[model samples]
Every structure is written in C-alpha cells, then in structure tokens.
Target: MAKCDACGTTILFGGKRMGDQRYCNDTCAGQGVLLNRVRQIPDGDVVAFANQVHSGNCPKCSGQGPVDVRDSYQVWSAILFTRWKSTPHILCRRCGVKAQAGDLAISAVAGWWGFPWGLLMTPVQVGRNIWSMAVAHNPNQPSDALLRQARLILAQRSLQDGRSQG
Candidate 1:
C-alpha cells in the first residue's frame, strides 16, 4: 500500500511513484516537486542571496537579471573515465549557445589532453551536456523565488571565479 505524500491520504489504488515518490495523482506530484525545490536549497549564502533577489538588485553581478538561469550538468563515465563541467553565464538569450560551446571545448580538452580516456568519454559526455543545454529554459519575467535560486547559483560561480583568479 502507498500513501499520497502531498495530502497524506492513503492510496488504495491508482497510485504512482517516481524516484522515491508516492503520489495519488498528477497534482500531488507537481506540489511535491515545488516543495522539493524549496527544501533542496541549503542555508548560508543562499539565504543571503535570496533576500538580495527579493529586493530590486541582482545577487550575482548585481547587474540586474533579465538574468540567465544557467544549468550545469555533469556526467562521469567510469568506463571512459572522464569528468567534465562547463559554465557559460550570459544574458538569457545567448546562454544556450554559449553553454553548448563551453561544453564542447571542455570535453575536447579533457578527452584529447588525456588521450585514451578522452577519446572514450568525450563523445558521450559532450552529447549529454549539449542535450541538456538545448533543453534549458529560463522563464520570462522570472518570479522572485526563481531569481533567488538563480542568485544562489550565480553567487557560487562568482566565488569560484574569484578563487581561481587569486
């Protein structure tokens, strides 16, 4: 027997589950995702960034968003044994194209530079990143809550950039 996670109702039949989920219907599944996204946000800088986003300013560059939501996807193949991550921060319009380019560049360097492993891992990992970037979508007139999520991401990148520079 499964129980609806959202409403806590006992699910006698017609229940559904996806990735450790138990739900009575589609509506509950949607609610579960929203709640999960909120819960996944960690503390510390994200809290600070969320506050900043709720206000008028951008938490990242403070450059004001119309901001792009960058989604970085990582793939590791134990057989081919290559790990790659690529990031491209741009205006919402160009983010997709830039992400694709960055992924290809990173994958190629990791693969060819590494020789055998690069040849094996580069193709699949590059393909995965390309697909993800192609599907990436940033909402129009992003809500404050969504901006807060983006803020957390961008702030982390900024810190990384600073560390790498100095």
Candidate 2:
C-alpha cells in the first residue's frame, strides 16, 4: 500500500499519483507539491523571500507588517480524549496578538482535564503562546515561521502556474 506523501497515511484505495508520490486527496496532493518545492528552495534565499512577503498587506486585515503565526491550544474531554489544535494565521501584529490571546484563554480554561497528557501539554502550549507574544518585539520584522510560509506561498504559486500551463 502506498502512503500519502504529505501526511504519511496509508492509501487503502485509489489515490492521486504524482511522479513517485501518492496522495489520498487533493489537499494532500497540493501539500506534497508545495513541500517538494520548498525543499528545492535554497536556505539562503528564504530570508530574502520572507522580507518580501512581510512588505505585503496582511491577509487578515490588509494591514502592513504581516507575519505568519501559529497558535496551539489543547482541549480535554471525558478524561480520556485530548485534542490539540494549532491554527495558522498571516496577520499584522495587532491581529496576531488578538488571536493568540483568545487561543491562550481557551487553552487555559479547558485544556487540563484529561489524564497525563492533558495535564502536561496544557502548560506547555500555554507557555509557548505566551513566549510567542513576548518575543514579538518588532512588528516590521518577519519571523522564521513567516519565512517558511513565504516559501510555501511561492511554491504554491509556481505549482499553480505549472498546472495552468500543462
């Protein structure tokens, strides 16, 4: 059985095949293509690309100084099930701060009810969000994650162009 190139899930039935990679769905296929393209980009060029992306308007609010931020939260239910969620956003400092604050509140309120993992992970996730907020001292500078996101965006655009032409 072929495994999905993007998520490593086993392909139990028919799947999309691109070159040597197989994907279970269109989303996985798109992700796989973007990952492949990102791998091909040189590390030296990523920062430059990120700077270019930072200069553009935020996808969320059309504001300047857009940066890519991912905030995670945990939720526990029935003492046995734990859910960890990470949300990604491309926004200016004001919007990112608001989103992070909301996720942090949710995690703090509802993330510590399960057995061992919920207890352990809730603090970690909360701390990570706090640290992210504290360290964002400059709104104008693009973060490392923003750099990676920029690379992915470039790859996606290239892939789209290739698809349109082919």
Number of the top TM-score candidate: 2
Residue runs of model 1 more than 4 Å from their true location after superposition: 1-65, 72-83, 86-91, 113-116, 141-166
The regions of model 2 sitting more than 4 angstroms off are 1-30, 41-49, 66-72, 137-140
Which numbered prediction scores highest in lDDT against the true structure? 2
Q: Write the per-residue lDDT of candidate 2 for residues 135-163, one digit (tens) a residue.
A: 66355677777777877877777788889
Candidate 1 to truth, TM: 0.37
Tell me the whole-model lDDT of each prediction, alpha carbons only: 0.58, 0.77
Give per-residue CA lDDT, model 1, range 60-120, as digits (tens): 4454445444554433334445565554443443544565666666665555544466665
lDDT score at residue 114, model 1, on the 0-100 scale: 48
